[model samples]
Target chain A: MKKKLIVKKNFLMSLFAVILGLIAGAILMFVTGSNPIEGFYYLFRGGLMNIERIGNSLATATPLIFAGLSVAFAFKTGLFNIGGAGQMLIGGLCATAVGLTFDWPKPILLTVIIIAAMIGGALWGALPGLLKARFNVHEVVATIMMNWIAYWTVFYLVPLYLKGPFLETESQRIPMAASLKVSWLTSLFSGSYINLGIFLAIIFVAITAFILERTTLGYELKAVGYNRDAAEAAGIGVNRNIVLSMAVAGALAGLGGATFYVGFASNMQIGVLPSQGFDGIAVALLGANSPWGVFAAALFFGLLHTGKGFMNAMTAIPPEIADTIIATIIYFAATSVLIERNWDKLNKFRLALRLRKSKQESLEDDSGGEQ
Target chain B: MVDLIYQLFPYAIAFTVPLLITSLGGLYSERSGVINIGLEGLMLMGMFVGALIISRTESIYPGTAIWIGLLAAMLFGAVFALLHAFACVTLNANQVISGIAINMIAAAVTVYLARLISGSGNIQIIRGLSRQTIPILSDIPILGRLLFTQTYATTWFVLLILVVATFLLYKTRFGLRLRACGEHPHAADSAGVNVYRMRYMAVIISGACAGLGGATFIVTISGEFNGTAAGLGFLALAALIFGQWKPWGILGAAFFFGFASTVANVSQVVPMLAQIPGIYLKTFPYVVTLAALVLSSKYSLAPKAIGEPYDKGKR
Candidate 1:
């Protein structure tokens, strides 16, 4: 019971936010004259009703898990990495380029592709880090700018080098050797788009959690996040950590990009920076910046997106309205800082009252025994 | 050359107004110790509201829809910004996260509402504002022809806003206190300025300016709100950085972007410009903005205490 309480306390705030988000979504549904309970019923059912849907949700969550980790990892180092979008794009681009050009054995090719994606993303992330560390250039503005640069780079590269026979807006379809999907896995999932990325995401989640919880590096990074000046005074290399943190973030986002372009999608599309990049921010926040929590949050978001179509089809709610509800929930979840502060205050207050009560009871017992 | 000037100058002014006003909007917020990265989202909100009002009420009030829409946009912007103000100032939420949330809300709300009302994502104005030349100014020489001819009344409104904003920023008591709060809120608090109130007011004013700018875009230039300001808000943010948060410098930067946008738009009409690929032309301004940011960020004089939520109890 005690252990359960402690576990609940650790995740209680995030769970509260989730419940509040659901209530907000329900309110929107009710206001729109639909039954909120029914709306949610179908929504969850669509994502989990069958083996195929479950497989699809997990597949959809694969990239989001990486994206969430990317954002969360940076948050631990006192950095707001809004450039995840650009990093993801560049990462995807590199992966696509390698996949399209090279012919090698599956193991070597996949390894090379993943490494290339990580490098591309790391380079993109490192620029903003260097700028912020060296030049005092605000990372937010620099990353926003970098997003556009990546956008145009993909825009130019797609049509110029890897255009398909019919479409001008996307690259050529990645061949079977370059793809992440295998015949046996597809068959097991009954023709779902499930791939190797899900397993990779799970392994990385465990790795990231281990790094953050059990390692000296993560401790130093967290210290930097808590107080940069204090950490600097304590002899931590502040600038190096900032850069290293961002590079790791970028690499994580790059892995997400690879999962997306190579595993889930057959070809790379132009003219869009992936929405998953931005969703990563929501995922990180919702997960309370925990690696395992990010996995769960990402899975939830994947369920929403995967089930969104069913909700639209079954109810009077339009797709745009559904999206509005989700974004509203995100808007509320983004206020987790305030919620966290309040929760901390409440805990302290409760602890203080309990201590006073125990002290008075002990004094009373002593008096009765003496009498 | 004459043809180029004639073609490009008017469009430049039209495009420049939003960038100028939005950056000025950013200036107010940042100068008052609040970092508002949601200017893009706020502008989108104003644009969609203004467009919706005009489109729906064109039949009811054809003569006054545009002006009414502008005011409506401003009102909507203030209300929306109140949410941001509440989050950042009162709740002490992470400013960047809140700003991003505000942006997501705006993007989501506008598209959903537009589709809900218009049965489509895009909202088109029935009649766009026409150009008006100043009566006495039209009779003047080459200067008048270059400046006054074939321009919307919002052009003059933009100039008026620029002057008033400059005056209010530099020459007023409130302005001094606002600047003081941004520089050192504790000092301002010691001097009897309410730091929270000042920051809140500054954010609201930022909203109003962004609203007017967004209305100008819908009323004069685009004649439609397509659920996006086409990233003009981010450009305005770039201008704010490039301008070093000065009014005149912001105007100059706004004009530079405005000219670039005009070049992008008029390339279809101009013979020399038509040779370039459409994609290249589209990407030019964004690339230039990035370059400008990289250069300008090196010398930026941003407010000292900006992005820090002022806590009065902290020494």
Candidate 2:
């Protein structure tokens, strides 16, 4: 019960922190000659005002959810997966290739594309994992280097293999069957391009939450995260856990890629990899590496992104300003020492309050006995 | 072949000078047990700051006073990169995440600040570092033209840094302490070396080096700051890894990468490679980097404790 209360307190503090950050961000905007009220009103309306807007938010959030899960899952297992961008690229291309070349029913086609994406991402991740497991090569270095390799390899191969009607540099579009259908509400905003990939994202989020909280594997992963040496002593295979963590992380990132291509982009067109993977790191961190936290964080980011675009369309502010706000918030968030310092003070205060109350109750009992 | 060499030569030198300068900066930081992933961000900030200062001052030499401004930026980067070091070194925060945070912060903040200063997202051309010709050496027919006819002050500065760093890392006691801290901080600490101080020193040196590299690229090569560092930080990083984290090795690798980069950019002008394949030729540098990375994986001789945080209490 005490542990639950502590967790609740931590959650409330994080909520307060986020609110403070947004307020700070708004003040900065106001000082910069932009009306914070209008800017944010536009941002919120753009994100949630209509069904089409909601669809757009969901579309943006879809890939982020996967990337967040990727980073979060890895964090839970005492590893850091920095190669999400490269893995996503490989997954995107693999899924696109399957989506374009294969001919099958809609369900089978989607399944194949997703599986292919996961496999491609898994292979990208596993190489670094295997290298680390075998050679003690730091996963950070290997994964970062592999990201570069995967990016370039994909960049080089895509133009050679998939150049289509979009002209010289771009890729061919995926087939109709491979594309995801938008919901009825989304269709009401007929011209809007949002799809139903958000449903898949939510489903995955639920599955991940369940696995982490309810499953033995989740317990083992948490154990490894808390203390790898202790987990190893308890008969957990640390190497296996690390590799599996990366593999799962890659698969999630891969699913993100699949959603991006099948639901959003015209093709698997990528001259340079999207910054989605890097953004996912921000998402995961802001969410505090929890499943629900990730969902909320993704939505917040999604709203900010959509609103930034709307602001650019409506006002004089450059869209990049939104990015600045986000970066600042995340930078502050990564200053975990600040959080720890505050928590220490809070704990001390609570301890003192408890001691004072206990003494007063004992004094009352003593007085009653005398009477 | 002569035409291809000629086309590649000028650009090859151009590419190598900036990368060499930057890779050396990375070496300084990594050798100190702090990985400077903010190299790219620092470079971006430097380019903008350097250009703005130069344009405003309107004199290349005095405007070059902006060079000192980079120390401010380096301090910022050191503080910023220290976030990574602290996460890794102190609280045992994942080095990669901390690095990514720096990268994200650097990108966003620099872009925002650039707008505030320039009144636009991009800065215009200013008095860039003009090429200087050596009187006697410039007169030589072929080799002189290739090596001495025209170059930025930074090229010479990079050469000097390489020599000095090599001496510092291998010859000097300070170098020995730095390496010892990186390889085994606890051991270094036991030897009465302040491991934290050494690591901080390494990262600061790296930030300054990276800052200089950023300034050089903006003031000399691009003639303006348009955020065109173009993932050069990563290339420099790749160079650092490919160089086996040694100063001399890094110089050699930077030169090779520079050659590949020049070839990729100018392949259209080189008649022989033009017919071979445009797409393949254009992507040669990244491909080379990828190949080098794969090849290095076969025998990576990285510093023993490259990414691991230093802990005083842990034996």
Scored by DockQ, the top model is 1
Model 1 regions more than 4 Å off: A1-10, A103-106, B135-142, B265-271, B274-300
Docking verdict class for candidate 2: acceptable
Model 1 CAPRI rating: medium
lDDT of 2 by residue, A249-289 (tens): 88888888888877777586655666778888878877878
Top candidate when judged by lDDT against the true structure:
1
Per-residue lDDT of candidate 1, residues A194-282 (tens digit) = 89999989999999999888998999889999999999999999999988998999999998999999999989999787878877888
Off by over 4 Å in 2: A2-6, A20-24, A27-31, A103-105, A183-185, A188-191, A230-234, A367-371, B59-94, B115-120, B126-128, B137-146, B170-174, B186-195, B220-224, B274-315
TM-score of every candidate relative to the true structure = 0.93, 0.88
| Distance from true location, Cα of A172 in model 2, Å | 3.0
Alpha carbon lDDT of residue A280, candidate 1?
86
Q: True-contact fraction for model 1? A: 0.46
- Cα lDDT for residue A183, model 2? 50
Error of 1 at A337 (Å): 4.1
Spell out the clash pairs found in candidate 2: B87-B93
Write down the RMSD of all candidates, one decimal each: 2.7, 3.7
Model 1 compared with the native: what TM-score?
0.93
